[model samples]
Target: MKSLISRLCLYASMLSAIFWPQPARAYLGSFEEQDGYRIPLDGQILSTFLAGDAQFYLNNIDANGYTGVVPLGTYPNTLGDGTHGADLSRYNAGEYGTNHSGPGGTAVDITDNSGLWRALAGGRLNEDVNAPYYNGSNFTRDYVHAYRYSGARTGSAVLNLLASETNLSYAYTLDARDLNGTAPSATAANLIQMAFWLCPSDWDDTDTDNILGISLRDAMNQTVFQVGYTGDNMLQYRLTGGAWQTTSNRMGTAGWSELVVILDTVNNTAGIAVSAYDDNTSTLASQTYVLSNQSLGLDADALTGLQWDLRGGSLSNGAASFKNYFDDFNFTVSPVLVPEPSGMLLAGLAVIALLLQRKRH
Candidate 1:
């Protein structure tokens, strides 16, 4: 019986080692990890410091004159082609980076409205290229830039596929700040919400179910984070219906910012890191948020669902919209150190030491 008990103890120790946290790591939108250690999405991507200016395009279409959105087929993320009418290849040139004979450029356009809604999930801000932007105080050169919008606004998401085979993922942007230079003043009238949706466990991979979003809510008089919403940002994320959690000051820089989430399938956790643009002029830094909510967790082993969403709420001034700008959006997955319950392991060791001491006495 003693020998059997010893074997069980040995098994428990092994299990503890396998499940205990290895280290504490926070992955910004540009970084990720898997199975331990640091791992980045290698190869010629759209635009990363590692890409060496090698343009990021899907290289599978001829979308040159296709105006407006078409039915989404399968081009960027699945096993098919994007062609509903007028030879889809013509439209691919602007966004897919393959309009001309070859494929390599700094432009991406997706006007198709079908398939999965995550085709552009891994897009980065102009890759720190010939990027320029208006930094509220002044228009800065050689800085990442984006299009800002504010007002009674509405639009459709044109992506269709955002499945990640590799664990490496990304979500880059120039910045997410008050385009009108509005300060976080009393009774904010404007509200904004931006997020990447992930399908839930029960929903079909093709169904858009879950969402991870950052919202500016006038109702709460602050910005809030979301896990699910009523088809739009105004609803906010809730189980059946309730108030959402809030974050600190929203981003204020117009440099390089991103939202990175490391999906750990085995452990059922996602490490979230959000970095405001890191231009030397901007003092805002990166922050980390842990996503243990069911709606925010990984759908399957792979990121099978992704939806890019942005919406505006009514303002205190009764304004419908406030100008906002964001570019260089990317969302991929790699692996990194994740937090674990190590205190228990240490306590176990202390108990063993006490037992040994008693035996010796």
Candidate 2:
């Protein structure tokens, strides 16, 4: 009986050693850094959202929320001066430069004040500032000075709004000219923008000349969720190789829908999942696509559409452009787990065996 009890104890100890959970190691990547910029949580101060002046920007708010703009600096351009035209001139600056590149040539600045109907206003023209002309053309006129506010900017009292909402939303106008220019190289450093293609009406290969809607040049490689455009359009997600895969749902043209994509760096796979949601329902509409063993070796720079010849007709004319809006964009460096070798598990088992032997003796 004593020997049996000792054996039982040894077995229990061995089981625990084999099944013990390993501690997850810190994820090694850009998005995982503690100081990395991220969307603010709800109820946080608006001043904290800016790169500087956490308190000053927050303090000047009136009961109605009227603060001034906080300059984010310039937008960065990679191409040579005026190569793609003045439409692409905005890229000559840095990340937050005077020239806006997406929809119009509008540069966006943030404001702590919500009382003002427009949170985003345009910067002065190059000639107005007497800045040197990269392009010799006199077309560097700045117009369309409008104030665009984030979704958070619209909610709450001007003062309370800054203090309460932790996150703000913003969108800019974009045009075909922005998409027609060269695509930048992809690296670990840049944050690339990605889009999904939904083709509901027909998959006619001739009509298939349309480029995938997503564009990423200097974008950080993170998992992003995208929604399929309504209509008879088939939902497609592109991987690094430029190849696309379809989703399960046959989406209709009723309204906007949602899809989730997980970009795994370890396995080199872009895991895609789709779901359909309506303003009226809490139940999720979902589908999953597991794209494994993808050999599409798309370099970061190549994904920008710089090298590929534009298609003919509307696509060739650069008018049949793809448009997408991203919200709640998020990415996380998955914590790494170092697995204990089988030898370690055996060592634990040996120790348990000795202890049991002693107990029996």
Candidate 3:
């Protein structure tokens, strides 16, 4: 009997070790895990950025000719292959050694549905290319930057999908690197609200009822699906009935968090997966959150656009500003499968319970 008890204990321990959840390695997708210079030219639009670089894609289509924002300056109507039209000035170009300190220039509040702006950092009045935005390092590498401008702001894009594209999947890596504040270390200064929204084809930028600068409540009332990150570090989503719901786990304070949203219009459901990496680029096991098969608000055939919003938190002046970094954006017609708790882990727990009961007898 003693020997049987010892063998059972060993088996349970080995099973637990094998089935326990582990941290996931960081994934950078098409973009490199490096820093980048601030976008040189002021008010540069995403449409032109797509026309210049082929690296960005929308629903498997090369990111070019998509219309959502106003043109910043003179650009070639016809762009050649490669990064021809996508130089630093056309994109985020600046002098290699110049200290770019400016209160005005390319930085503009996106009020007229002008899409996203490219800058070195956010929540700071000075748009300095050499500003150390992350961990005492200058901003480098290529990623979309989002933050609160004059009011709340959203980096938006329009999706022109094919008729055959029924269901949709969208994904991006988000780096909630740091928060800038006036009081510096005040507790209220720690948080800023951010969210991602999936909108239907009928989403109009010109709607008078639409608060384009900040909230998406009007859009959310439509067929839009939303995933939100609160100041408390919790991940929340919109239910089919139009109310917001939170996941079981909270996210990490800093690092890259990958969010994938799958919209299934045929089944009237949507799903989301949220995972974050530590400063070391390794996944934080405690921050993984997934909500699958949530109900949708309205029955729709297709989704046409998406928006990412950032709102300022706890601020009287320069203090308490937040920045969100996005990269490796993807969209497709195929289905996406989010990771869930393992069945083996549950089985291992059951075995341990049975063994303990026998030992007590």
Estimate TM-scores for all models. 0.33, 0.33, 0.36
lDDT of 2 by residue, 150-249 (tens): 4221212111111000111112222222222322232232222222212122222233333323322223332122222222245555544344455545
Task: Indicate the worst ten consecutive residues by lDDT in candidate 1.
Answer: 28-37
**Per-prediction tally of clashes:** 43, 51, 17
lDDT of every model, 2 decimals: 0.26, 0.27, 0.31
Write candidate 3's Cα lDDT for 1-361 as tens digits.
3334434443343233223342211111111111222221223432224443332221122243222111121123223322222222222221111111211233222221122222222211121222122222222112232211221112122111111101112222122111111121221111111222221111111221211111112112343467665444455676535555655544443444555555554445555555554444545454232754455555644343333343332222212222333443333232222112464456567788999999999
Q: Model 3 lDDT vs. the true structure? A: 0.31
Best by lDDT: 3
Sort order, lDDT high to low: 3, 2, 1
lDDT of 1 by residue, 1-361 (tens): 3334433443343333333432221111111111011111221223322211121222212343211111122123222332211111112212222211212343223354221111232211111222232233321221111111121011211112111111112222111111112232311221111222221111121222222243222222222223332221111233213455433323332333344333333333333445543334665464444333233322223222322332222222222111122222232222222323474466567778999999999
Name the runs in model 2 displaced over 4 angstroms: 1-210, 213-232, 238-243, 250-254, 277-284, 287-319, 342-361
